[model samples]
Target: MLQMLHEKGLRAEHCYAAGIASIGAAFVSWMLSQRMESNGIARADRWGIFIGEWAPTFIALGNGLRTYEK
Candidate 1:
């Protein structure tokens, strides 16, 4: 997967940027869910959590890609 990502031109910087973006996205998702969902805060929390989880995966991928780059 790491090799494939590298081959596809996905650099560590791109993954790092995605991880940072995901954090912001989580906040936006939480806010949107809170306003739009019937379940309110609980739903918002879930939305926030789901998106927040992506950051770690992206960061890990970034680290892996960095190794590949070297």
Candidate 2:
């Protein structure tokens, strides 16, 4: 996937950056949930998991863009 993105002109660096950002977002979401009084631990965990899933999609998009660029 990295190779394909490179071939298309998409940089691995961009994908990596996006992945990092997604991770950060997930972390923030989790943290916010943790602070919520009404939602509790289970809610926080669910939110964290949901946000966590976004990281992969961002990474995949980045990879696809890179491939296309190449």
Q: What is the TM-score of each candidate against the true structure?
A: 0.94, 0.68
Kindly give the number of clashing pairs for every candidate: 0, 8
lDDT of every model, 2 decimals: 0.96, 0.76
RMSD of 1: 0.8
Which regions in candidate 2 have their CA more than 4 angstroms from the true location? 1-16
Best by lDDT: 1
Error of 1 at 26 (Å): 0.1
After TM-score superposition, the amount by which residue 21's alpha carbon in candidate 1 deviates from its true location, in angstroms, is 0.4
The deviation in Å at residue 47 for candidate 1 is 0.6
Q: Estimate the lDDT of model 1.
A: 0.96
lDDT of 2 at 35: 94
Query: Per-residue CA lDDT of candidate 1, range 1-70, in tens?
Result: 9999999999999999999999999999998999999976987899999999999999999999999999
List, residue by residue over 1-70, the lDDT tens digit for candidate 2: 6566567666756776878887888889888889974858888888888878877877877766655555
